[model samples]
Each structure stands twice: as structure tokens, then as C-alpha cells.
Target: MTGELREAAEPTRSEGATYYGRPVIKEPVWKVPDVPAYLYLGGMAGAAALMAAGAGLTGRPGLARAGRVSSGIGATASVAFLVHDLGRPLRFLNMLRVFKPTSPLSVGSWVLAPFSALAGAGAVSAATGLLPRLGWLSSSAAAVLAPAMTTYTAVLLADTAVPAWHEPYRELPFVFAGSAVASAAGLGVVAAPAAQAGPARRMAVAGSALEVAATRRMQRRAGMVGEVFGQGRAGRLLRTAEALVVAGSVTALLARRSRIAAVASGLCLTGAGLATRFGIFEAGHASARDPRYTVEPQRLRSR
Candidate 1:
């Protein structure tokens, strides 16, 4: 028998089928249904935190109260969806039992613990109409948690076996972090006037800079794995995000010319942030679809 035939005898593809290259061995553990729901809810929580902070800064007690309430509701809903997706809700508690720096889930659980606490405090402060009296302390706490809560999902996904996610680890966190900042800025613009939104605009600009830099780095660092960012659905979403972020930054910087332009900039930045999350999720799925992602990485490690 030929060497090809011998290799074919133990085919990589499913039984009774013959293909030259390896077929998919492991499929994506990250379900499609889980991705968007998680991303949206997390962003919502982050946005609420930003809004609450901006309200506190601008002396808008009512907006601060509303922002806190919204944050709590978002966090609660996010937890519900996460548990439902896991199928065995009890496993979530076990996630908190230990700390492993190498395990994204463990780290994320820790991040969530404080995030949830801050959200609850914000909710209580708002519900009791006490945020004004508590001063910047409550808002400051929320601000600190906002970025972590918003960005850690990227790490959670990256720590997994998925090739696209794992390979892009360095840039993924920054991508999510940038999105969080931009999303927060968008919320600030909607909740506060120009006086307070100035800081938000600056935040958005910083985020855009980070996002662009991280994306370039991802393209350079990821060899064949990075192909997803330049092709298919993932490519399109990324392209759109790039355009939106750049345009938004320019408008924000030049918004002194027009208020309508400033609003448009905020809208674009918000849209870009959403697109980045969706793009990353889609790229992970694409990477999982091919067996190369699974077998190659393992084989490399073994060697």
C-alpha cells in the first residue's frame, strides 16, 4: 500500500470519508447564542457605569440615579443568561471556589465579584436617592469596575481552546478594553451635556487610538490565523469598525464646529464598539470551524 493510503487508513475526516488534509476534530465550545447576549449585556452595564459617573460629575442627580438602576438591571440579566447558557447553573458557583491566574474563567469570576458588588451598591444608592450625599465615592467605585467588567469577556474567550481567540490574546483584551471605553463615552454623551461630555470625547479618542493600534498589532502578530480579520464576515465587521472609529474621532475632535456633528460622532463610536465585539465573536467561530486551529496548536505544544 502507498504511504498516502496508509495515512488515509487512519483518516482525519469522519469515517467512510476521505480527504487529503485533516478534518475538524474539535468544534467550538462557545455557542453562538451565548456570544451576542453576553457582549451586549456587558456593554450595557459598562455604559450605565459611565453614565452614572458622568451624572455625578455634572451634578445631575436624576441621571445618576437612573444610570445606577439601569446598571443593576443589566448585570442581573447578564448573569441570568450566562447561567442559562451553561446549562448546569450550579457550575458557576464552583467557578468561584478557586483562583487560577492561567484560567480566564477564574480570573473573570473574581472580576465579576467586585463588579456585581459595585453594581448593587450603585443600585442601592440610586434607589434610596443617596448618591448625591455619598459624593464621588460611589461613582468612583463604579468607574473602576466598569472597564474590567466590560473587557474581561475578551480574556474569557481568549483563554479557551479556540484558535482564533487564543492566537489573538494580546490584542483581544485591548480590543475589548477600547470598545468598553468608547461605549462608555457614547453613554456619557447621551446622558450629559457638552460640559461633561468633553471628558467623554477625550475618552473615546483614547479608545479609538488603542483600538487602531491593537488591530495593527494583531495583523502583524497573527500569521495565518489572522486571515479571518482580513476576509469573510469577520473582515467586513472589522473594516466597518475601523471606519466608524476613525470618523468618530475626527468629528469629536472637531465638534466645536457643530453640535449635530458631535452627536453623530458619539453614535458612530457606539456603533463601532458594538461591531468590534461581534467581529471578534464571529472570527472565533470561523477559526473553530477548521481543524487546523485545534490539531496544529496541540501538535506544536507537544513538539
Candidate 2:
């Protein structure tokens, strides 16, 4: 990301605070679809790698193969979105020059770079039935990196000045992890046969539960700043996401019995994941633009 920010309006004084309607911090200049899509896809890919690894261990070759393919595609698309947002592919490469543990972006770049390559290599080999050793190695490596890939974005976002993201840092990762799990399970359910889909259906339920719990906790803990997630565009998207999660989890029970139900459940889960990412993205930006979110939190802590 450019990290460039939009200028806020001039401050107007009121009640000993820069009150009324104005931003206290600069809003992100990140464009639409690019950043949000990147987050969603990256998380999904990360979680998919884990599922792929699990399936491999349990002798479910079909699910394992499908997960590898799904992970590869998601990772590839994620890189594309990141590059598009950066406005140049070379910028991403530059980030790999050094590993900065303190900087989520830097570490994320390194993680994504290797993870994508390995996942892609694994997917190709698994699909084409070539380079079996290379496929096993790369896929195994990717799974090791998947947890980081899935959650570093939450850290990156919370590290920012945006109150909606920063104040809820403690809970954001759980929400994101759950979102990723659900999305990965969605893919598994859609791609694997009914007999091989039991694990995926269980993941859908587990992920949905975790996501809902974390989201609720985050919002409640955030106090006033949390309002951004419950109002305007963010609210609409989040509500939709939660609804989809409910529908998908419920539908997944019937998925093993019917292909149509599996497709429907998968769609709902994926939609929920997409909507959750975008909704969180929107909430962060909205919080950044509002002075109250930045000011009120500090004010409360001082008391």
C-alpha cells in the first residue's frame, strides 16, 4: 500500500476539542476493490493451504488436491490485487529486500512472496501429476506460512491510526482467522465430493461461530469508535456478511446429502468472507475520517 493519506479539513475549535465534523487523522488513499479484495483472497489462500495440508494427512487426496488448487488461485489473485494497488509489480519485490518484524507490511510481503510461489508450484504439480517431491515440499512450506499470511493484514490495519482498526486489534485477528477458515471451507465444499466434504462442513460451522464471537467482542469493546462498524456502508455489508454466515452454516448440514445444497452453502460462505473483509475495510476508513473516534477513545482512557 502507498500509505498516502487524504488531507482532512481545517480544524474548528469547540468545547476544548477539535469537535463538530472533521477528521483528526488523514484518511487512507488506498483505492477500492484492490485492497479489500487483496485481504479477502490472501486470507482465503492462507486458510486453504492449511486445509490442503490436513486433507493430505488424512488420506483425502481429492480434497487435498482441490485445496491446493484453490489456494494457488487465491494467492495468485491476491498478489495481482496487491500489485495493482501498489501501481507497480517492482514495488512488491523491493519490500523483500529485508525482513522487518516490526513492520507487518514487510513481513507480509516476504510471507506472501514465498507462499504464493510455493502454493502455485504445488498446485501445478498436484494437478499435472509431475514433480511430486517438489509439490509436497512446497505445499508443506506454504501451510507453515499460511497462519501468518491469513492474519498479518489484521496487524497491519490495527497498527494504523484508524480507530476502528486500532482499538479492536485484540479481536481483529480472530475475526480474520475465522473469515479465512470459512472461505477455505467454502471452497472445499464446492470442489470436493460429498463423501469428502465432512471436514469442510464442520469448518464452516466452527469458522462462522468464531467470526461472530470475535466481531461482537470487538464492537462491544471499542465503545464509541465501534459505531463505524455498525453504521452506513460498513453496517450494511457486515449485516449481510453475518446473515450469509448463518445461512451458509445452516445449509452446510444438507450439503453432504445434495450437490445443490453444497453449491449454495459454498457460495454463501464465500460471500460472507468477501463481505466481512470489505466491511472491515470500509469501517477503518470511516473511522479515520471522523474526529470523534480518535478523540473520544483517548478521552475515555484519560478518565
Candidate 3:
């Protein structure tokens, strides 16, 4: 029988054994409204910070302004989502109480604190024409920090026990980085002037290409756990994200001379990024929900 037929004929249990419907791995308690939003916004802000610096250096004032605004807003939203996830805003302070080099969350909190301030300062300076020099300094600093800000979330997710997430540790960082770039580039394509949006359009294409490649690689290497990404709701979302990314990339290439095409491509890429994030999250959730994912992997590992 084919894999799909076998799956249809049998429940997602390991080798005719069952765990009495109990999950072998505990499901993540992280709320959907919070963690996925944090991941998306944090990545968008990080990529925007890099774009802001690049645009400023290249003398594209309009694009720079768009990047600055996006970085600040995205950073703020990311923090809000994190705080909401924690259930108490004040609990965020505990994250700063110490620095643990081994802890991705600890490192992320530190990175976010300064990144948020710098991005905010840059945005304010652009908006109010105040402290231009300081704004330049902040934007520059943010650019340096932005890469870590975007990629550390991958480390955070990979550090987890969930098979779907932890198994693809090598590729998740690149996947997230690509998604971040695509999202920020999409924002620029939508908000920046046509003349200034050239780099953004190029970035959107490049980033989307990287995201698609990395995701496919991850799925291929994910072994039995990879099935989660191809089944049920997660599969639908992943398929949708892939379609949108392809469509957006093609539109971006063709958008060089058309503002309407640029806008449409921007919307498509942004939606693709969102769908990708949610799909990954749901895949992890589904993997944890199924005992086979947890048991089968370990059973193989022990041999």
C-alpha cells in the first residue's frame, strides 16, 4: 500500500502499539495568538532594521523612512505579543535579570531590548527631524544586531523537544532569515517609492527563493517527522505559503516597471511569510500531538 493509503488505514500510532491516545511529547503551551505573532513581527523588524541601514547608506531617503517605520512598529508588536504570551508584562523583566549564553530566550531578550530602543529612535528621528546624527548611529547599530534578532528565534524553536521543530535545526535559521527578508522587502515594496523600491523588489525575490529552498530541504531531511508538514491543516497552510511565495517572486521580477504589480507582489509575499510561520507552528503542534512522531524517532535512534 502507498504511504497515504497506509496512513488512512491506520491511526498515527507506532507499530500497532498505542499510548492510549496520550501524546508522547507534551504539546507546547505557548498560545497561538502570541508566539506566532512574536515570531513574524520579530523577524520583520530585524530585516527592516537591516534594510533601513542599507537604504540610509545608499541615500534612498524614502526607502529608509519606510524601513525605519516598519522596524519600529514591528519591534513594538513583537514585544507586545511576547508580553501577552507571558501573561504578565512585568514578567518580561525577569528575562533581563541575568545573561545566559546557553539560553536562546535569554540572549533574545537582551538583543530585543537594545534593538527595540534603537529602531524606535531611528523611526522617531525620521518622523520628527530630531537628532539625525543619533538616528544614524541607532540605525547602524540596529543593522548589526538585526541578523541575530531574526535568526535566534529559530534557535529558540529548535531548542524545543518537538520533533518537527528540533529535527530541522540546521535549516530553520536560514528559513527564518529568508522569511524575514521577504517580509521586510515586501513592506518596502508597498511603502517605498518605485525608484527607491528596486532593492526591495530584488530582496523579495532572493529571500523568497531562499525560503522556498530552505523549507524544502528541511522537510526532506525531517524523516518521519516531516509528515506533519504534509498532513492536515499544516499541510494546507504550507502549500498555500509555497504557492504565494512562488507567485510573489514572479510578480516581483515583473514589477520593475509597474507600481500595481509591485503592490500585488508585496501583498502576496507578506501573506506568504505569515502563512509559513503559522504552518511551521502548527506542524510542530501536530508532531507533538501524535505519539508516533515521538516514539518512532527514538525507536530508530536507539538502534
Candidate 4:
């Protein structure tokens, strides 16, 4: 009984409250989860802007009108979701008070403000039929902002302390861009007639190609935290994503003439995009829950 009491008196590794002797390695943090919602909406807006540019260039006024309307709606909706998630909507004005290149949220906010304005203008012009005169200007602006909108979400997420998200920074932007393009293409197919949806199909092909490449690189390059991509729920979702995207790409390319094939590919692309987004969210949360991801990397970097 005395020997057992001595063993119990010794401190085990678990006796320390926090990792490494620090009382508080990190404070209790709560970030707004709706940021991703804004990201998804912003991606849609970017794609819509690109579609508007293409439709205007192709001389399809009706398609252009649709694209403008879609872009405007997407941008407005993103802002609404962002504010709704902010906990205090009035504080949103502070986001516009300064320009901070180092701050992704600030930069994205400013970028979205103007992009939304331009998109709104394009939509109104299309509705009022004034875009014929200002087509070049609006199209030029939208084209420039389209890629940024498709990609900035990567920076936005990486700015957070989430291990899975931060470690895979190199590939996330491409993955997001690819997914955005695919989603945009899918939206195009749904909104426009088969003939006008040609560009959307092309976008899907390009986007899927990029997404596959980026996702593969992420799995290969991220060492440990990226391992989540191949484990548990994340692994299942990513595998399903790859299969669907590949099948959809093949179907779209080989079955171009078949409406059924086009529809199938579009649906697959949409599903893949959704899966990737949700999978990423889940993976980040998983990484955050484990202390190793947060501490080990920082220790190595400091050393």
C-alpha cells in the first residue's frame, strides 16, 4: 500500500494542465463560421462576373443580362451572410475604415465592396439595356476582379490559426479557384440554354482539371496535417469528390453532344465543389482539436 501511494505521488505527463508548462498556450477563441458561406457566395459572384464578360463579348445580350443579375445577387448575398455572422453588424463599418494589405479580411472586404458595386452596376445596366454603351468598361472591370474573387478565400482561411488550413496554403488557392470555376460552370448550365452554356462547360473542364491537380498536390505536399485528407470523414469526402469530378469531366468531354451527359457532369461538378468545401471545414476543425498540430510545427519553426 505504501509503494502504491509513492507511485501515485509522482507526476505523470498528463499532470500538467497545458502543453509544455504554459498555463494558456492559446486563449479560448471563437471565429465566425459563416466566413465560408461568404466565400462560397463570393466564388459564385466571381464566376457570374466572368460569365457576364463572356456573354457580352459573344454578343449574347440575354446571357449577359443573366450573368450580371447572378453576380449582383451573389455579391449582395455574400455581404448579408458576412454581416449576419459578424455578431455585431454595426462593427462591419470598421472593416472599411482602413486599408490593410496584411489583413486578408480587411482587404477582402474592400475588394468585395467595389466588386459588388461594379457588379450591381452591370446588373442594372443589363436590366435597363444601358450596358450596350458601357460594355467595354464593365466587362474589363469584371474580368479583372473575377479571378481574385475565386481565389481570395484561400488567403482568408490561411490567415486563421487552423493547422490543416494554414499548412496546406500552397494548394488551397488553386483548389478553391478550380472549385469556383466548376460551380460557376454548373450555374451557367442551369441558368442558360444549352447553346449559351458552352462557355460554362469549358469552365467546368478547366476548373476540374485544376481542382484535381491541386488536391493531389495538397495530399502529397502537406506532410502531416494534410494527412486528414486521407483519413476518416475527410478522406471519404475527398475520394468521392475525385471520383465524381473525374467522371463528370470525362462525361462532359466525350458526351458533349448529349444533353443528359452535360447535365450529369454539371451535377457532379456542383456536388464535388460542395464536398470539397465541407470536407475542408471538417478537416480544419479536426486539426484544431488536436494539440500536436498547433504546437509541434511552431516548435520546429522556432528552433
lDDT of each: 0.72, 0.91, 0.89, 0.75
Off by over 4 Å in 1: 2-25, 43-74, 88-91, 123-128, 131-138, 254-259, 294-303
Candidate 2 per-residue C-alpha lDDT over 1-303 given as tens digits, one digit per residue, 9 for 90 to 100? 233432234344552364656688998888789999999999999999999999999988888988899899999999999999999999988999899888988888988999999999999988999998899889999999999999988898989898999999999999999999999998899898889878889998999999999999999998988899999999999999999998988888899998888999999999999999999999999888878888888988999
TM-score to native of every candidate shown: 0.78, 0.94, 0.93, 0.83
Which parts of model 4 have CA positions greater than 4 angstroms off? 1-33, 60-63, 127-139, 254-256
| Model 2 / residue 199 / CA error / Å | 0.9
Per residue, candidate 3 scores C-alpha lDDT tens digits across 44-111 of 99999999888988999989999998998899889999999999988998999999999998999999
Instruction: State the lDDT at 96 in candidate 2.
Output: 94
- The positional error of residue 295 in candidate 1, measured at the CA in angstroms, is 4.5
Model 1 whole-model lDDT (C-alpha atoms) = 0.72
Q: In model 3, where do residues sit more than 4 Å from their true spots? A: 1-21
Per lDDT, the best of the predicted structures is 2
Alpha carbon lDDT at 296, candidate 1: 58
Ranking by TM-score: 2, 3, 4, 1
lDDT of 2: 0.91
Ranking of models by lDDT: 2, 3, 4, 1
Candidate 2 Cα misplacement greater than 4 A, ranges: 1-15
Better of 3 and 4 by lDDT: 3
